[model samples]
Target: MKRLFAFLFAALMLAPAVQAAEAPDVLIRRLSTEMIDRIRADEQLQSGNLARMSELVDSVLMPHVNFQRMTALAVGRNWRGASPEQQKQLMTEFRALLLRTYAGALASAKDQSVRMKPMRADPADKEVIVRSEVVQPRGGEPIQLDYRLEKAGDGWKVFDVNVLGVWLVQTYRSQFAQEVSANGIDGLIRSLVEKNRSAGAAGTR
Candidate 1:
């Protein structure tokens, strides 16, 4: 699951933001390519500077992603049980968790490049799947990647990702359920915060 999330998000995490008006496939292509190029050229990011990467994720990638939807999906049916305040907290912590994990992935991804497959979706459809491949430039086989997006107002927002046949939201749902079952939402939030803090410390070093 850790490796899956890393592969699933590495392309979108540290990229330069694209226009909201771009089609989903176009958006993925542009961002994926730009992220690879930019991350390689970026001294601080390539050196694993968490602060710089976090700033980019918060300012740039967050808007392009429907994180509220992501949090709801990850939390599953229990999402409706949370108070509005709890929901807000969950989103905050989840965002931090993803940013930290993504920063780590970006730092480690040195010889990888993203390639977009031909997109196949009707223009009238409100939901679409954008498919792509991640090339491991050093050798071996490419990875299968797909972004599941839904129309949100004028732009499409990514809510879940499928990598090598496993959906990221589904992968986390079981973990979240276990935590919620044992300790509840606040417990889950606390867990995320602590993990992110530890990851942050590692990133700084």
Candidate 2:
């Protein structure tokens, strides 16, 4: 699962939008390929420069994601318990956690490529799931990766991801629910903050 998430960091690094109306599968495939090439050629990123990798993900990958929805979904029923301020804080901390994880994982990216599977959705559908897999360079089993996206304005925004048979939002939902149950919404925010802090410290060393 760790390796699967690592591959996800590469696959989800969608580039800046060149076409607002681009098909979801095409968008994912093109940008993932571009990112793989960029990572392979960039010495700083390959050398584990978290700052650079994080910046790259923030600038290029985040724009395509509907992070507010992702955060809300991950929080599950507990999301309604959060005040406006708490919700904002939760989003901030969760986004930081994801950014740091992706940045750290991307440092080891090499010869990893995304293989896009067939997308099944009506053209008029507002939401859809795009399936895919990570083709490892070492010829290991291909890891399953899927994306749930919603049509926003003139483009698509990813809200959830499935990696190695586990959905990202669902996995986090379980953890967030446990935290909220034990210590309330504010407690969850604090926990996320501490987690991000610990990860940031480890990255610097």
Candidate 3:
């Protein structure tokens, strides 16, 4: 449920409209609208096809996210101690975990709408947080979501998410740290791989 909440925050908030110059809020608003419409129309997504949903996330959403930072933060202080190969492995597993977790959750976007608060940031600032609310259908209460983004060379990219006041990266960081401490870094990777595989298998069932 926490993973779904985190990804729902990402899917609804991290989208960037890359057509022209814009603030982070405008970019999010534009892409969220566009992607929400696309999700609504995609029969595969409506049917909860995880493969197709992952493809959508990879093609459309991954580019706008700062996965390197996310992976490092989730790995916590143990990251610098990891070898290059281990780092790569960690990133790969972390990426797979996110894609698999969020792919299934993406289907929940059906009939959801988002509203943004005023975006506050200096034009010269390199990073900022954007806040918004997701309105679920059938008169459900709105979910509070926030995105933390930094100005990469290409443009602003999301690195962490805050859902209902809890930070996404921080949440995963604690879990990753505990898992690595118990079984080791390689064990952490294996666990993530297994979780992703289970998600995939569940999708096929």
TM-score leader: 2
Model 1 CA deviation exceeding 4 Å by range: 1-10, 13-17
Q: Give me the displacement of residue 97 in model 2, in angstroms.
A: 1.0
Worst lDDT run of 10 residues, candidate 2, spans 9-18
Give all candidates' CA lDDT scores: 0.79, 0.80, 0.75
TM-score of 2: 0.93
Clashing pairs for predicted structure model 1, backbone only: none
Candidate achieving the largest lDDT: 2
Each model's number of backbone clashes?
Answer: 0, 0, 0
Put down candidate 2 lDDT per residue, 60-166, tens digits, no spaces.
66668888999999999989878999999998999888777666666555678788898899999999998988887779788788988888885888899898788
Looking at candidate 1, what is the lDDT of residue 167? 83
Candidate 3 has a TM-score of 0.89
**Alpha carbon deviation, residue 102, candidate 3 (Å):** 2.3
> How well does candidate 1 score on lDDT at residue 131?
91
lDDT of 1 at 130: 96
Q: How accurate is candidate 1 locally (lDDT)?
A: 0.79
Worst-scoring 10-residue span by lDDT in model 1: 1-10
Indicate the worst ten consecutive residues by lDDT in candidate 3: 6-15
